[model samples]
Target: MSETQKLETQISDMRREKNARPFTLAIASGKGGTGKTTLATALAEAAGMGVTLRDCDVEEPNAHLFVQPHWSRHTEQNRPVPRIDAQRCSACGKCAELCQFNAIAVAGGRAMVFAELCHSCQGCRRICPEGAISDENMPMGSLDCGMQLKDPAAPINFISGKLAIGQVMAPPLIRAVKNVGAAEPLNILDCPPGTSCPMITAVRGSDFVILVTEPTPFGLNDLELAVETVRQLGLPFGVIINRADSGDSRVHDYCRTRGINIALEIPWKRSIAEAYSRGDSLCEKGAPAKPALPQLSATWPTTVSVPTAMLMPPICT
Candidate 1:
């Protein structure tokens, strides 16, 4: 067998073994408007039954618009914020001093807790010498459990997290959404944009990652940042160039130089864009993009394999 064939066999076997447990695939982008959601929903549809799609983009999750799963359960998620006990007396400013985020402050012989500033680390509660610090559950967001209700036998389990209107942090809520869907054979996490904590939290535990990017200058710039991020994370990942024919060849060159595979190149199509605007899935029947999506899903492990050497090396600008 050739080197490529041998590698393909090895990866295929590895994926089969890993499928016995939950196999998570996270779809992420360095910036927004990179067709991250478009590819994510397409892949999820192509995976067919028993696949769980977790929309971890808590701030502005829109995957539901495409799948349109019938939501069956709604849950309110909460984070533990430090609540100071005035009766415990002796403020002594210990809790405030221990808080790195300045979520707690000692004023007027009392301590005030800023729920918005709290990261839910519980550091202040742990360090309070006077035992004046306690935990209060602050509402972080909501989680909705739904499925492709149209077909009960072949349901696509859909779960999404939505951050509260004023909530500044999203990693905690993203973590909550990820905690579920462990029992499914395949889980696709649609991560938030950028290389911040929220995106990191979403993609951290995935078995494989698919970074989506366009070929424009902004896309190339952020894709470089995202490539660096997944490299730092030590995760196996590949790039999918959306609108592959629209921009310059710099993105292609970057992948070539790094020995990174451009797993798939989706050329721009006006019909696909029009269908997407109407909340239609790429893999749905009569959809303009249906044909190309199956080729992606059918390739699977062979398509996603990244060279071990490529994943380890420092990315160049």
Candidate 2:
């Protein structure tokens, strides 16, 4: 049996053993430098839903810098890549011809497989009449599991997956982190920055999406992009303006014109940054944003209650 088949079988077995009832919420931004992680952690702490934090930003996960976690467990996440058996050698160039990802190349009576380009489709193996193709697992990363120690009085479960350095793909790791949290918990996924594959993987199947943005020109530009991304996904999403008072009013203006709910706003405050630098929980510091943060916890259920079509604007233009 190929490695891909074995891994798929394992995943199926695990799913059968665990019946998961999770409410996945993704925190996203259209660009980097936005406070996606900060808002995700704060909202998780505020919701008090025994939330599991998945730092889907495998490229650079920083949530742990704030929410201290106890009892971390590391587990390997891997993906399948095709392996060619030269000895079984028909070298007819069939595999290379069939591969859509350009993962296989044949030249000079030799076949080379570029594992990174492989999407693990297993088509090459199935099509190989000579049985020269097989699949193998490549280590992607390790997932760290622990509980957030925001309040010694109440702790929340947190899990993050760190992709192996130099790994290009991150969606697999994000999916792995989320799979672990799906067993029986409410989840708040701190998605990676940008509105690309990684962001889509993080937000896909989420109950709600909270897009964090500022009010500057750059912020407005990115917020529009993020909104369009979520809209394209047909997911229910709202806006949260961070550094709300510092920039132009265009963000609020855009939201008002679209009828998008301004879920919460973290004002421009030196203390917020100071507390963050000190690795202090916003709840403990009485951060001016605390009240506003918890207000989201109250608003989320109601937002979910409204029909998605009703919340969306008449025309996305």
Candidate 3:
């Protein structure tokens, strides 16, 4: 057998032996630039426990910019992509006809397959009577996991994945990272921006979701979409208003009216941003916000409910 085949077998065996622990927390936002990563890393560090960080934002992963991890293992995340055998293909367009994703198309008496478009559903292979469709493992991305022993006195483990450029599917890589770090070590999943498939996959299995947002009009709009996404997934989540004082109070009002809890409000502060840009944990700097970290952590399990009405009047954008 080829080396790839051997590697595949080993990975399969490893997954079969894997048993994931619960209590995954997903940090997500309706959009980017909301300091989601900053809050995620801070919460993880301030939790001050053995936690595994999974940066699921494959499109533009930047968590490594802050919480650096010592190298442990980097493994390729691959998925089965269909390959058509020219000799066996009958040009009957059976494969193309069966593919719901439209990944396969026939023209000029031959069929072509688009790997990126394929969702690996295997419908084409199953429907093809000619047995012309074969599946091959295609490289998707890479997952890096390591221990964050930044201070010899303090130790933490982190796992992150970088999706290959042009790779549209990020859920697979996210799952790969999670699988590798499934020791149930207080997982903090820093999900990708947006309320789409990638975000859904990242937070689907989490125990709770921390929806990070700002106080601007755009922030409120995106926060609603994000809340809807998490609610549709039936996951309990709360809001963390980053840049709390930068914009209108619409986010607070909306959260209150919708019966969503505003778990934490990170005020708009230049020092906080500067510290983040410089790769320093706000909790480590003895920043004023540092003291509130413990309170935020303690509220996770008990404060699961949101208010049904707003006491303060809503502010116009």
Highest TM-score against the true fold, candidate: 1
List per-prediction Cα lDDT, in the order shown.
0.82, 0.77, 0.76
Predicted candidate 3 versus true structure: per-residue lDDT over 1-317, tens digit per residue: 99988867765554444323435678999988887898888866765555677888887888887888887788888977789888988889988888878899999887899999887777888888889888888888898887777655446678888989888877777777767764644678899889887888888877678899999988988989998998899887878888888889888889888877777778788878778778887676666567656656445444473221111111110
Q: RMSD of model 2, in Å?
A: 9.7
Candidate 2 residue lDDT tens string, 1-22: 9998886777565544332555
Displacement of the residue 157 alpha carbon in candidate 3, Å: 1.5
* Candidates in order: C-alpha RMSD to true structure: 5.6, 9.7, 11.3
Candidate 3: segments with Cα more than 4 A from true spot: 1-20, 90-100, 108-110, 151-154, 305-317
Residue 282 in model 2: lDDT: 58
The candidate 1 region of ten consecutive residues with least summed lDDT is 308-317
